[model samples]
Target: MNAWSNDGLWLAGIAAVAGLTASAASLGWLFSRNRYRAAVPDSSYPPEVLESLYHHSPIAFALIDRQGRFLDINRDPADMIGYGKHEVSGKPFLSLIAEDMQEAVRGLFLRALQGEQISQEIKVKHKQGHAIDLFIQTSPLIRRGRTIGILAFIQDFSERRRSLERIRYMAYYDDMTGLPNRQYFKKRLEEKLASARMRGSMLAVCYIDVDQFKLVNASFGRDFGDMLLLQIAERLSRSLSEPGDLARMEGDEFAACLDNLSSAEEAQERLQEILSVLKEPFELRGVPVHITVSIGVACSGGEDDAATLLKRADTALHRMKENGKNGYLQHSEDMDHVAMEKLTIQHEMRRALENKEFVLYYQPQYDLASGQIVGMEALIRWMHPERGMIFPGDFIPAAEESGLIAPLGEWVIEEACRQNKAWQDEGLLRIPVSVNLSFRQFTEKNLTSKISGILEKTGLHPRYLELEITESMTMDVERASQDLRELTEMGLHISIDDFGTGYSSFHYLKTLPIGRLKIDRSFVRDIKQDPSDAAIVAAIISMAHKLQMQVVAEGVETKDQVHFLRSHRCDEMQGYFGSPPLSSNSAHALLMEKVNRPALPAYH
Candidate 1:
C-alpha cells in the first residue's frame, strides 16, 4: 500500500510543477515582447520601419551606439563627404568629427545619448578635399527604458554658408574696383584703431581725391571710367603694401590707413612717393590720361580716433583743393581751426546771401590815354552785422568752395545792375558797369539764361553791362566760346581779366568773342621798373589791338607807371593812383562829376 500511493503522489506533484513552469515561461515571453514593442513603437524594427525612416529622410542620418561608435550612416551624408556607406559604418564617430568640433560634438552626443535632445551647426572635413558646414540634430535611441544609441539628423549647408559669405563680401567690397568700400573701410579702421590704442602707436589717414576726375569720367565713357578706377585701385593698393589697408571712399576718392608710423615726416615721405607715382600718366582704354591727386594727411595723436583722423584728413584735402589742386597737405591743429573757420564762413555766407547782407562797391576804371572815368568795376563787400565789411578776399573763396558762388554771383549781378541803374537815374555817369564772374558761375549750364534773367529783372540795358572772366577760365575754349558768343549777342561787353599770367592758347583766345583784355596787375605793377614786364605789357597791348580787343592796364599806382602805360598807348587804367575802391555813395558822386580826359605827356 505504501509503494503504490507514494509513486502516484510523486508523479502528480511533478506534473503540477511542470504545468506552473510552462505558464510562467509564457507570461515572461509576453511581457518581454510588449516592452520591446513599446521601446521601438514599431512592429518592424531594424529592417523595414527604422531602415525606411533612415533611408528616405530628406536629411542625412547616422545611427550611433551609446559608446559613440557608428552603427550605420545613410547615403546622403556619405555622399556629402565623398564616401560610400561601407567606408564609414562601424567607425568611431568621433574620428569623423572635425578636430576643432570634436569636444563640442562629443559633449552634445553624450548628452543626447543620456536622453537630452541637441542641435548644432558644426564644421566638418570632407573626403573631397574641402571643409563643409553641417546642421546636425541628435536625439536618444531608447530600448526597454534605457538609451542604447544616438539618432543623428544631419544636413549639408556648405552652399548656404557660401552664399552668406558672398553677400557679406558684396556689402564690404566695391563692385567696380574690388577695393573695400566705405563701410568695410570704417570697420577695418576701427579695428586697427583699437590695436593702435592698445600699442600706444600712431596711425595716419590719407584722403586722396583725384583732381578733375569729373572731366575724366565725362570724357571717357563710364565703362572706361570704371576701368580707370580699377587701374587706380591697383596702383593705390600696390602703394598700401598691406592687406586691408586701402579702401575706396567714394567716386574718384580713395582713403588709406598708414599704421605704425613714427612721425608726420614719415607720413609725408610716404605720401610724397605716392604722389610721384600718381604723376605718371595712366593708359586708359588706349588713351594716355594724365592725372593728379590732392592728398590730405592726418595722423593719430591727442585723442584722435579713426573718425577724427579721417575727418581731419578730409579737411586737409579740402584745403589742398582750395589752395590749388595737385598737392598734399599734412594737417595741424591750426589747419583744423582754419578749416572750422572756413566752415563757419561758408555757413554764414549762405545765410548772408539769403538775408541780403551783401552789397557791391564800385571801383573807377579810367581810360589810360585819357584819365576820364570810362566805366566802373563792381567789387563785392559783405556788410556782416557783427564782422563789419568783410572784403571779397575774405569770403569769395569760401563762397566758391561751398557752391555758394552761383547764388552769390546772381546777387552780385542783380544788385550791381540795379545800383548802376539807380546811379544813372540819380544823374551819375551812364557808363556800362563791369562785374566779375567766377569760374564756377561761368561753367554753370544755365549761366547764359541766368544772366539774361537777371538783366531782364533789373530792367538794365544789356549795353550797360560788362562781364569779366579770368584768362585761365577762357582756356576752356568750347565753353568759353559758347558763353562768350551768347553774351556778345546779348550786347554785353565781355573782357578777359588777369591776362598773360595764364599761359592760354591763342587759338582758343581768338575763338572767344572777348571785347577787351585786362593785363593783370602783376605785370602792370612792375611795368616801368622791369624791362621784361614792359615788353610783356607792350606785347599784350599790341596783340589785343590786332584782335580788335581793347586793352585795360590794371594797378597804375604811380605817375611813372601811368606815363609808361600811356607811352605804350594802353587803353584803360584804374588804381589807387586814380582812387581807391569807393562806397556806393562816393562812386555815384564820382560818376556824377563830368571831367575831360586828364592830360598826359604826349609820347612821340
Candidate 2:
C-alpha cells in the first residue's frame, strides 16, 4: 500500500509539471499576438515606423527654443540653409532668418512658447542671398506636460505664391489691355473717393468713349479691331501717366480718376493730352485706322459717390457724342436737368402709343413731270392732350431711344394702310402710301408676318405700302439683304430714306432690293446755293437711276428747290412746295379734288 501511494504521488507530480509547461506556452502565444495587434492595428504601421517614414521628408524641419534659438533641425533644414545639423544646433534662429524678418521670427517663437501656434507665409532669404517664399507652421512641442520647444515645418512656396499672384492679377486686370477691369476699378474708385472726401482733395472722373468703333469693326475684322484697341490702350496709358488711375471700363470705353489735381485746369490739360494721343492714327495690323474719343468729366463736388459720379460722367459723355464726338465736356447742372427731362419724355412716350395719342398725317408726293399726286408719305404727328401737335422731329428720337419705335412702327403700318384704303373707299385718288421704318423696326423678328397682318386687317394691297428706311439701315448687309428680299417677295416697295446723310455705301445698292432713294433734306435745302450739295444730289439721282430706282427729294420748301429737283429729273417731290403734312380729312379732300380737277402747273 505504501509503494502504490508513493507511485500515485510521483504521477501527480509529473502531471502537474506537464500542465505547467502547456500553461507557459499558451501565455507566450497570447503575449506575442497582443504585441503584434498593438504594433500593427489594421494599418500595419507602428508609431516609431510611421515617424521614421518622414525622417527624410523634403520639407525643412527645425526645433526652435523659447529664446528664438535653434535647438535641433532635420537634414532638410541643414541642406536648405547650407549648414550641418550640428552646426546649426543651439544657434539663434533669428541668425539664419533674413534681417527684415528677424523681429517677426522672434515674435512667432515667443507666441509658440506661450502655447499658441503660429503660421505664416513669408519671403525669406536663402544662404545664397536669393529670396524664396516659405509657408511656415510652428507648433509648441510639449514634453511631460510642459512646452519645451517649437516644431516648425517650412515648405518652399515661392512658385506657388507666384502662381497665386498671377491668378489674382488676371482676375483684376483686362487680359487684352492689362488695365484694371470694371470690378477692380469700381473698388478702387470707391476707396479713392472716400479718401478724397476725408482729405478735402479734389477728385475728377473722366469717361471716354471711342467714336466710330462700329465702323472700325465693320471695315476691319474683330482681330484687327482688338489690335487697334491695344494700341489705343498703350497711347492712353502714356497720355494719362500723371498721378492718376486709368482703367478700361468696357468695350471701347475707358475711365480715369484724377485725385489731388491742383485745379480744373489741370484736369482739362490732362484730358487734352489724352485726346491728342487718341487723335493720332493707330497702325493696327498694318492698317492705319483713325479713331476719335469723346470725354466727359465729372467732379466730386456735384456727386458724392462713385455711382452718381459715373452716371454724371456718362451723361456728359452722351452730350459730347450728341454734339459730334471727339471733344470733352464737363458735367453741369443744366445737363442733369436735361437728362431728367429726357427721362420724363421717355416715360411719357412709352404711354403715347398705348394711350391712342399718336396720329398720322399725309404729305402728298407730287410727280413733277405729270404735275399729279403719285404717293403720300405717312408722317407721324403726336396729338398730346396738353401739348397739342408734336412733330416727328421731337418724339422720334425719344421713341428710338426707348425702343418703343418697334410697336409704334407696327401701329403706323396699320394706320397708314387703313387710311389709304379709306381714301380709296371715299372715291378719292388711290395712291401708294409710304411709312418710315426705324432700324429696330426693320430688323424686328416676324416683321414680314406683322406687315402681312396689317395688310389683311386693312384690306390694302402690299404694292401700295412703301417702307422708307435710312441708308444706315442697309449697312448690316447680311441681315438687311434678307429683310429686303422678304419685303420685296411680299410685294412691298422699299425705299432708302435720307440717302446721303449716312455713310452711304454704293456696294449695298446693287445687292439691296430697293425701289427708290430719297435725297435727304440737308442736301435738298442747300442744293440751290451749295456746290457740294448740288454735286451730291446729282450723283445720288444718277446712282438711283443707274440702279433702276426712283429718286424723291425731301424738304423742298421753295420754288427754286422744286425747279432744281425737276430739272434734275427727280421722280418725286414731297415737301412744303407740294404740301405740308395735313390732317387725314384734309388729305382725302385734296385727293378727291385731284381726281376731279385738272392737274396743277408743274412749277406749282
TM-score for all models, in order of appearance? 0.82, 0.74
lDDT tens string, model 1, 299-326?
Answer: 8876666788888999889889988989
Extract clashing residue pairs from model 1. none
lDDT of each: 0.78, 0.78
For 1-604, candidate 2 gives per-residue lDDT tens digits of 2111222222222222233212322222222334435544736544344234335445555656566676555444544555677777777767777788878877777877776657787666667777677888765654435565666767778778889999998878888888898777778889988888778888888998989998888888888888888888888888765523888888999998878876899888878888888766788667777789999999887338888899899999999999998899999979999888788878888787679999999999888777789999998888988889988888888788888888888899999999999888877776899999888888787888889989999999899999999888887899999988998999999998888878789889999899899988999999989999999999889888988999999998888887888788988888898788889988887887788453436653
The residue-level lDDT of candidate 2 at 123 comes to 64
Off by over 4 Å in 1: 1-63, 69-92, 115-117, 141-145, 197-201, 215-220, 239-241, 262-269, 272-281, 286-292, 322-327, 595-604
lDDT of 1: 0.78
